[model samples]
Target: MHIAPLSPDDPSELGGYELLGRIGQGGMGQVYLGESPGGEPAAVKVIKPSIVDSETRLRFAQEVEILKTIWGARIAALLDADPEADPPWLATEYVEGLDLSRHVASHGPLDALLTASLGATLAEALATVHKQGLLHRDLKPANVLLGPNGPKVIDFGLAVFAESSVSLTAANTVVGTPSCMPPEQANGEKPLTPAVDVYALGAVLLFASTGHAPYRADNIHLLFHQVVDASIAPDLSGAPEELVPLLTAMLAHRPQDRPALDDVIRRCRALIEARGLKVAQARRRLTNFTAAPAHVLDDLLAVDRPATPGSTARARAGAADVPPGQGESEPEMLAPEAAQQEPGGFRPDRQEPEPPHTPPMPPAPVPRPTDPRLLFARIDTPTPPPAGTTTDEAAVKPDRSRPSARPAPRGGTGTGGGSSAPRRSLRHSAQARITAQRLREAYAANSPF
Candidate 1:
């Protein structure tokens, strides 16, 4: 927010991607929208060679060389980059939706389902990056892209590895957005484990649900004090009931205290699917309304804004066909039919799948986590799905006959806390809710985020 907007008035050039218009600028650098000779679009980040230094640029160039080896749709595609080029430039896929920070500011806090869906997706993406032996040292709202497929995590310029950097001194140089950063990051500590990303994601979910971070201040020093000492919990009054548990586990102070990315995705996705079922009902009840701007200023109350265009539009249109007054608020307990079910719950995402199921495009997982930290593959790579499990399970029509199993995270690191077990099981969403509730109760006694 401190930086000025990158305007079209300036016509600068970098390598092959001709700078079309300035996108925006921050402390570290300025980004411009550009297009290749093939007319493919790209977001080119242009940073001063002096600010980052020749040695830094070379180090970064090496990262770019490694980035070329990666291929994933969820991640912004890295077309071309030049660290050795004057002022240094990195270009990634030009995603259409606004960045998470801009999206939140313009649209206000995200609805429960949207936030949960995004949380799950981002965790999966992070897992992919970590698996490639690369460390995304900086992860914040600005780096996440909101797309029809879900949230696409962007920016790997700050990526480091066990061999990439010679010193842990990189952390002390001060990178990362302060508010969303974890305690270890804000304190200038080095050799940060994957836990830091978990902590950051938790903080992001908090911001999405509550529209505020764990702490805030004009001065970075003060913010760090609050992050380190105050233990000030976020006010979750605005968060959905089911997501509280996952958020609390993510924001745990100690690195070990936080859940791994895979668990984070599993828990968040379960909550999302549950809320998605209700969105069907919510769509029906949105009577007596007018079209609003793409941006929403008020989202604290879970207001039913009309769905966005594209795939979501079709989904919402179908959902709106449900009759009114069918039900209100989530059930305090499952109905008799739900109780009689196999896992004993309402599982819309699972079942045999009915007709007209809208599926999201599958994105490739991040290539690998390069690194100082031990990167594990089973935790992030896509499993040859179990027998009878189709590659596109999540996209299937609503089916209540079969019980719901937790959706597997498509990308991101798997929980590697040992014993080769996921930090969380893809259990029934309802059971996960029960477990989350207990965790939330414990967190309530201790902290809110």
Candidate 2:
């Protein structure tokens, strides 16, 4: 796996584990390379702040519980998690090797014997997950890590308890990669069983042996249709001759038609033995063939490089965007008594840095007043009286811009200037109307002119 430099926005420490760099990021959250206080390596996955709604939190908590119950040699083990953390995060054993997708893309497809070993190893892992009443809903080449031992499956973000009555996704929304998705899942089939994973394993093996999935389409919709169509069989064109029958059965359109996980494991083991190597020996061979050199990973991580100023700016900027009432508290240093914590392992040594204060967004600045002459020019423009109103009537109307024409100054009410008052009022009213009209026109045209 390529270790990418952490961005300014990424948290340096989560749940007490010091995050070294980012491993990968997606719509859900980011995965980082972390080191525990005792120096154990971990892959920490933290949920994104934007998606930390109630439902997403519940799902994340469920994933933590599920991971706790799962234990197998062919899967990355969960090390720590905090569902109630600011954004919530979980850490797993950091498998130090390239993923299946990258391995194949760089070095080419594996031979039939190695492909069988991969299938057998992953099939066993799925079997363990199924025993715990959960389903790894999303299994693809990218999720499998080729460590020193064997192929280990990772990323259980899409896993769900296999309850027939429960719906895993929202209405009309299906998850999982299209290329590796089984027909039942693509169709939103109910009561999803273990066979879905079996089908995915077949696709992974096919990719290993042929460097492509059974079905291919440029559009996601077309791919879904092909996966769901019973008539459109998977294309096993370049697959090894010995593995075609197993793959075809595994890729069957109907879930019930797919082979059981135990059967799949048996077939893969049989294939390995037929090639004159025990399953154990073949697994070791697969690892040796695909393991990346240590120097490559060290360079990718840039372990000795110091943090740059740009990264700190990014961190501060991200902290400023955090909303009130959702501020993250600094993690506390581990105490001797807290060493054996359960749900989330490891105590933090230092408090998380206080997020930089964010000033309230100022109201959009009002447009600065233009030249005073321009304002007078708009007001001076002539305006016609309203329809059906005589010019005299319009002039007599009240002019709010100036004091009301007083009651002839309470004495000598001989209509002094009274005749001129109406004309003055009319001019003011007309100017007001003209000014309003011009402003409306300016606004409609999206300019101050």
* CA lDDT, candidate 2, residue 3: 56
- Residues 328-433, model 2: lDDT tens digits: 2222111111111212221111113222122222123223224333433322312434568654454445223432211111111111212111111222222244
| Highest lDDT scorer | 2
Compared with the true structure, model 2 gives a TM-score of 0.66
Count of residue pairs whose backbone atoms collide, per candidate: 20, 5
Model 1 ranges off by over 4 Å: 1-9, 49-52, 162-165, 168-172, 230-237, 276-449
lDDT of each: 0.54, 0.67
Superposed model 2: Cα runs more than 4 Å off: 295-449
**Model 1: per-residue Cα lDDT at residue 153:** 73
